[model samples]
Target: MATHVLIIGGGIAGLNAAKSLGDAAGITVTIVDRQNHHLFQPLLYQVAMAGLSPADIAAPIRSILSGFSNIHVLQGEARSIKLDCACVEFDFGVLHYDYLVIACGATHSYFGHAEWEEFAPGLKTVAQATEIRRRVLAAFEQAERIEEPDEQKKYLTFVIVGGGPTGVELAGAIGEMSRYTLARDFRRINPRLTRVILVEAGPRILPMFSEEQAGRAARDLEKLGVQIWTSSIVTNVDANGVEMGDERIQTATALWAAGTEASEIGRSNGMPVDGRGRVIVEPDLSIADHSNVFVAGDQACFTHQTDRPLQGTAPVALQQGRFIGKTIVQELSGKPRTQFQFFDKGQMATIGRSRAIVEIGRFKFAGWFAWVTWLIVHIYYLTGFKNRFFVVLQWAWSYMTFRRGARLIVEKEWRMNQLESEEMLVDTTDDMPR
Candidate 1:
C-alpha cells in the first residue's frame, strides 16, 4: 500500500504540494483546512477597492483538486497533533499519517498590541477584505449624511500603517478608488475629498526594493494624493483613528499591513522558530530532526549563505513547496535527495493606472511600460484562466473609462457563537502559541 500523507492548510503551498505529490502513484493525500474556498491573496486589495468581486479571486478548494481521485479536501480545522503517534487532531476527529507536510502559511501580527485590531484591520483573507470594503463605503455614506465640518474631516481621512508592498498597493488603490472611481458618483459627498495617509516606522517605504525604485513608487503615489510619512511609528490605534508618537490623526479607516508571522503549527509541534514566529528549517526545507515533516511557504524561515531569511512571497512559497514534494517522492522511490534552491524573480508594484516600478535583474523600469508589465504579471500569476480574463477586462475598462465596477457594498450576515467575537472574525484554529 502507498504511504498516507496528510497536508494541513489549503493555501498555495498546500495545494501546489498536493498537485506535485498527486502525480506520483505512491501517495494518498488528504488536505484539511478551515475554509473550502482558496483565495488568491495577492489581489485582495483589488477586491477591497471594488475592482474585483470576491468570487473573481476566490475558488472552491474542492474544484481545484477535483482531478485527483487519491486526494481529498476536508473543510474543517485541525486542533492539535500527536507527534509521537504521527496523527493529527481535528474538529472531525483524528487523521494518521506516515509523512506530514505543514504549509499553513502566516497570520497578521499585532506587535503584541491586539487591542489595535479594533481600528486597524489587516487584509489577509476574503472576509477581512469585504469588511474593509464595507467600512470604506460606510465612511463615505456617513460623511455624506453629516453636515458638521469636523465630523466630515474624520470621515474623509484614511490612515494606512505600514510601508511594505501590501501597504503601498492598498494606499494607492484606496486613493484611486476615492479620487477617480467615486469622484462623480456621490451627490452629497466627494470621495475625492478623502485624504490617504501612509505611515512607515522605517526610514523608507519598500525597503526590500532598490532605493531608486522605492523612491519612484513613493513619488507616483504622492502624485495620486497619498500622504506618505516615513520613519514614523504608530503608538496607538482605536475606532476613532491612529496615534503616532505624539501626533494623533482622526480617520474612519486605518489599515494594518506592517507584519505577519507563521501559523502556530510549527511552534505547537515543537519546531524551532525565530523572533517573528517563522519555523526554522534546514536547507532542504525540512524541520530540524524531523525528515518526514516539512515546512514551506510563509511558514518556513530558512537562512541563505548571507544569513538573510527568505522573504514571504508566493514565488518563494511555491518553489519551496514543489521542492519538498520532489524530495519526498525521491525518498519514497529510494532515490537521492537534493537540496532546495530559490530562483530570484524580479518584483514590481503599480501605483495607479499608468504608474508603476519594476526591477528585473539589472534592468529597472518605471512609469507606463512598467505598469503594463505589472498588470500582465499579476494576471499570469492568477490561479484560473477565468480569473485572469475577468481581472484583465476589469483593468482594461478601468484604464480606459477611469471607473471601478465592483463598488457595490455587500453586507453579508452570519452567526457566531457567544464565545466567538466577530470583529474581523479571527481564525484561531491555527493560533497555537508556543
Candidate 2:
C-alpha cells in the first residue's frame, strides 16, 4: 500500500506543507479545507481599508498546487480524526492515512461574550473584512443624513477594543483616510473631526514589543489624532456604543482585535488545549499519545528552552509547518526525527504614511525610516511578486495623491436579502416540482 498523508486546513501552514512536500518522495499527499481559496490573513486589514482587493490577497487552492501530480486538493470540512483506526473522517468520507497534519488556524475569541461579535467583529477572513468595510463606510453615510448632533458623534467615532497590531494598523489607516483621503468628500461632517479610539485592557499597547518601541508607537498614533485608552476594559458592547468599566463611550463602529482561540475541532476532539484553546504539542510538533496526528500554526503551542511559550506569528507557523513536512519525509525514509527550531524575524507595525516602528534584536528604529523598513518587509513577505508590486504602487499612490478608489460598497444588505429570498423560492419550487 502507498503511504498516504492527510493534511487538514489550507491556510499558510497547510499550503506551505503541501508545497514543501510536493510528490518527488514516494508518498501521496491530500490536502483538505473547508474553503476553496487560501487567504493572505496578514493583509486582511488592508482589504478592510480598501487598500487591496479580495482577489489580490486570495488565491484558488487548486491553482497554486495543480502542477503536483501526486497531490490532491479536496474541499471538505474535517469532522473528526479516528486515532485508533489511523484514519481521518470528513463530512464526505473517511481517508485512511499513515500520517496526519492539523493546521487548523485560530478564530476570534469573544472572551465568553460571544454576542459582542455582532457589534465588534474581528477581521479573520474575506467575508468578515468586507462586512466590516460595509459597516465602516455606511457609518459615514448614515451620519451625513442624520440631523441630531448626538447621533452624528456616534457615527463619526470608531472604537477599537484591542491595541494590538491589528487595532493599531486599522486605527492609523482610518485616521489617514479621515484626515487626508476623505477629508473634503463630506460636506456636513468634518472628516478631520473623526475620532479613532483605541482601547487596551493592558497597561500598554503592543505588549509583545519592547517598552520603548511600544511607547513610541503609541505616541505617534496619538500625534495622528487617535485617542489611546489604556488600562480600560470593555465591560459591554452594543450597537450604539461600548461600556468601559464605569464610562459609556458611544461609537458607530467597534472593532475586535483582542484575542483568538483554536478551532472548534480542537475543543470538540478533547485535545490538550491551553486556556486560549491552542493545542499543546510535543517537541516534534505532535500531539501527546497521538504520534500520528500532528498540529502546528496558531492552533498549536510549544515552549522554548527559556520557558517562553511560542507566540502565534506567521514565521512560527511557517517554520513549524515546514519542520513537520521534513519530519514526515524523514519518518517515511526511516530517518531520525528533528526538533522544531524557531527563528524570530523581528516585528514591525506602521501607524501612518511616514510613521512606523521596527525592532530587530537589540537594534530599534522609529519614525519615517522605520515606516519605510516596515513597508519593505511586508511587501517582501506577501505572496507573489505581482501582489507585492501592486501593493507597493497602491500605497505609494495613496501616500502621494491621497485617493483610494476602492471605497465603493459592493455588497449591500438589501441585495443579500433579495438573493436569499430568491434562493428560498427556488428551493421551494424544486421540492414541489411545479
Candidate 3:
C-alpha cells in the first residue's frame, strides 16, 4: 500500500512539500487548505495599497500542482486531528494519513485587544487587503465630500500602527498615494497635505533589520512625507483614531501591521505549543511522541539553534517544507532522517519606489540598487510567469507615471447590510433608554 501523506495549509510550506514529493514511488500527497488559491504574502501590502490586484499575487492551488499526478488538492478546513487514529477531521469528512504535515500559518494579533480590529484592519488575506484598499480610498472620497476643514483633515489623516516591515511599507505607500498618485485627482482636498504617521513602540522601525538600515529607511520615508514615531506604543484604537501613551491622533483610517499568532490548529490536537501558540516540534520538525506528525511554517516554533526561535519567513518555511518532504522520502526508503538546519539568506524591505534596504551577512546597503534588488527578488519568487510579467509592467508604469493601477474602491453588500444593522440597533437602544 502507498503511504498517504496529508499536508494542511496551501501556503509556501505546504505547496513546496507537495512539489518536492511529486511522483514519488509508493507515496500519495494530499494537500488541504481553506483557501482555494495560494497567496504570495510578501507583496500583500502592494495589493492593499492598490499597486497590484489580488489576482496578480494569487494562483489557484490546483493549477500549480496539476502537473503532479500523485498530488491531490482539497479545499477544506482541518478542524481536528486524531493522533491515535492518524486521521484529520473536517466539516465534510475525515482523512486518514500515514504521515501528516501541518503548516496552517498565522493571523494578525491585536495584542489582546481584538476590538481594535474593527477600526484598524490588518493585511493578511485577499479579503483583508481589498477591504483595506476600500477603506483607504473611501477616506479620500469622504474627505473630498466634507466641507469642513477639520473634518476633511481628519479624513486626510492616515495612521499606521506597528512600525514593522508591513507598517513601514504601508505608510510609505500611503504617503506616495497621497503626494503623487491622488495629488492631481482630488480638487477640494489636497492629497499632498495628507498626514501619514507610522507608529512603532520599539526604539526604531524595522526592528528585524540593523539599526543603520532602519535609520536609512526612516530617512527614505521622510523624503516621501511619512512621519515616523519611535518608542511610541498605540494604547488604544477606535473608529475615530489611535491613542499612543498620552498622545491622541484623530483619523478616519488606521492600519495594523504589528504582531501575529499561530493558527488555531497549532494550539489544538494536544500538541505542545509555545506562548504564541506555535507547535513545539522536535529537531526533525516532528511533534513529541508522534514522529509521524510534523509541523512547519509559522505554526511551528522551531528553535534548532540557540534559545531564540526562527522567524516565520517564507524562506524558513520553504526550506522546512523541502526538508520534511525529503525526510519522508528517506524514511520510506529505509534511510536515516537528518535534523533540519536553516540557512540565513539575509532580508530585504522596500520603503517605496527607488528606495529600499538590503542586508546579507556582513554586507548591508540602502538605496535604489537595493530597491531594484528587492523588485527582482520578489518578481522572481512570484508563482506564475504572467503574474511576474504583469507585476513588473505595472510597477514600471507606476514608477514612471506615479499612478496606481488597481485603485478601485470595491464595496461589498455585506458592509452595507452591516451599517443598516448598526443603525437599527442604535434606533432600538435610543427608543428604550432616553
TM-score of each: 0.93, 0.94, 0.95
Q: Write down the worst ten-residue block by lDDT for model 2.
A: 408-417
Candidate 3 clashing pairs, residues 3+ apart or interchain: none
Kindly list the per-residue Cα lDDT of model 2 for residues 1-434, writing each as its tens digit: 67788999998888888877887468899999999998888778888887778877788889888989889999999998778888878999989998899999999988899999999999999989888888888888988899899999999999998989999998988888888877789988888898999999999999989999999999989877899999998899999999987998889899999888888787788888888888888889999998878898999878743366688778788888888888888887889987788888888888887998988888899999998887787777677777777888888888889888578686645564788899999999899955
Best by lDDT: 3
User: What's the distance in Å from true for residue 419, model 3?
Assistant: 13
**Tell me, what's the RMSD of every candidate?**
6.2, 2.6, 4.1
Off by over 4 Å in 3: 414-434
Assess the local accuracy of residue 379 in candidate 3 as a C-alpha lDDT between 0 and 100: 93
Per-residue lDDT for 248-293 in model 3, tens only?
9999999999899999876777789998999999999999999999
Per-residue C-alpha lDDT of model 1 across residues 316-340, encoded as one tens digit per residue = 8888878877888889889977778
TM-score ranking of the models: 3, 2, 1
Q: Which stretches of candidate 1 lie over 4 Å from their true place?
A: 412-434
Candidate 3 C-alpha error for residue 81, in Å: 1.1
Q: Measured by TM-score, how close is model 1 to the native structure?
A: 0.93
Clashing pairs in 2: none
